[model samples]
Target: MFPTLHIAEKTTGSRGSLALLRWALVVIFLWFGCMKFTSYEAMGIAPLMQNSPIMSWIPAVFGVQGASYFIGTAELVTAAALIIGTFNKMASAFGATMSCLVYAVTLTFFLSTPGVAEPTAGGFPAISAGTGQFLLKDLVLLAASACLLLASIRPADA
Candidate 1:
């Protein structure tokens, strides 16, 4: 019924989409991870870390600057493993798992951080530009990470 559409779909398949997603994740991790080394980024994230019950220990133990560095290192490592995973299935699974965990923690910022909801907008569904909007993207990243994880763990023969 849709010969041209089917032909186009077959020509440019799921592999392209998967590669795009993987590369996009790598870029995000690398860019954000590199930024974490800077003082401004460290200072910016201080409020979120300080407010988080689960992440509060990071700033308390490592200090603001040190915490950023630690997180940055983890992000860089995840990006590296993902890149290497192109060839190695084990690396891919590990990277996907790490990405999942990272996004899960960041997603909590919506609940833990103050001023996430715009008071003038009546709060709740209205997310503030400062922290709320920024963290919202993590929802997509978390989904991508989960998809990668499932793809990585599936039997090779299948």
Candidate 2:
């Protein structure tokens, strides 16, 4: 029904868009993963990790800074697999799976961490700009990662 839709689609077809999505995810993982090594970033995430039932064990076992390092290492590995995925579908599937898991865990911060709702704004659906909004973005990332995983598993002709 839209006149320019075909032109826009042709400009960046499905494959092209998928490639862009893949690269964008790569950048996010690489950048944030690297940032995990810094004391500032480590401390910034500590409260979230501390409150999470799923993540609290990390700090207990490795200590705060050590837990950050461990997470950073995992992210770098995911990035490497994604880079290699450009050449290998199996690698792509693996990387996408990792991406899904990472984002899923991050999304849980919305439930576990305090102050997700801005109490002054009447709370509940009224999300806080800081932690709540920051974490909400992972919903998109998880969906994107799922798409990549499905594409990796699909037949070549499909």
Candidate 3:
């Protein structure tokens, strides 16, 4: 055991970490959401979205440009709600819920999209190092979003 660590001190540190995590999430959502509005970003994700059963129809209904704008709007709104959470826990809780739902869909891309794994190295389940890595990073964001969800729901308890 570390003699230097104390319960109160640890709690303070944990709280600080959570605050930073929440703020980081807010920034990422806003930034990425803004990127979705650009043609480069839209096209970059189009292939993955097209292959996804859960997302394929998006293009049909909204078209690529429209879909990208919609995604950007959603992200902007989510970020706004999270910002509001700084004062209103209810708003933050709603934002966290939205974030959880979005992250869940992105996680599903591992199964829905092709070329996500390395074919030459091991093929199929092996997963391409780059794509696999990109998808893998979502787990941390998912966890952070979930933590925010719990915090929003429990408020005082969290």
Candidate 4:
């Protein structure tokens, strides 16, 4: 009876760990998504977007506030899906795609500029100096999202 209980306890612990991982991922998405709304200006991201060729068309079509709202909505929705574990795969894939796009845009900025210095304060360094670092960070995020997507597809028993 003691041995049997030990095995059962071990199994439960494993399941608990998996559940914890899922919740941790959800919280991560939520926190990051919320940051987009709260910290854009402080991070100097507003100006970067205003100057970005990749996003230039956004303001022309929707105006700055409208464009910000659109992007913010996307982030918020993805975060919601992650938190609720609804459409997890789709949310994760969308998140991964967004990260990739950000990486590309930042990389472009980094390459086009010269002699930019890394920011000592918060927020990303100016693209010219921080493109490589920015891309590296986003790639890591993309990998995490991809892993979550794969995990969502796996059978619970597996």
What TM-score, computed on C-alpha atoms, does each candidate reach? 0.90, 0.91, 0.87, 0.53
lDDT of each: 0.89, 0.91, 0.82, 0.53
Q: lDDT tens digits, residues 104-147, model 3?
A: 88889888778788889777777777766687688888888888
**TM-score of predicted model 1?**
0.90
Ranking by TM-score: 2, 1, 3, 4
**What lDDT tens digits, residue by residue, belong to model 2 across residues 10-114?**
322387778988999999999999999999989998999999999999999998999999999999999999999999999999999999999999999999999
The Cα error of candidate 4 at residue 67, in Å, is 2.2
- Order of candidate numbers by lDDT, starting with the best: 2, 1, 3, 4
lDDT of 4 by residue, 1-158 (tens): 36443444333245355456456655655665565555453244555566567876776687666666666666666666665554455554555445445445655554443334455544345433444454446545555554555556556676
Question: Compared with the true structure, what per-residue lDDT tens digits does model 1 show for residues 54-120?
Answer: 8999989999999999999999999999999888889989999999999999999889999889988
Worst 10 residues of 2 by lDDT: 4-13
Worst 10 residues of 1 by lDDT: 4-13
For every model in order, what is the number of clashing pairs? 0, 0, 4, 0
Candidate 1 vs candidate 4, TM-score winner: 1
Candidate 2 off by > 4 Å: 1-13
Instruction: Give the C-alpha lDDT of model 3.
Output: 0.82
TM-score of 4: 0.53
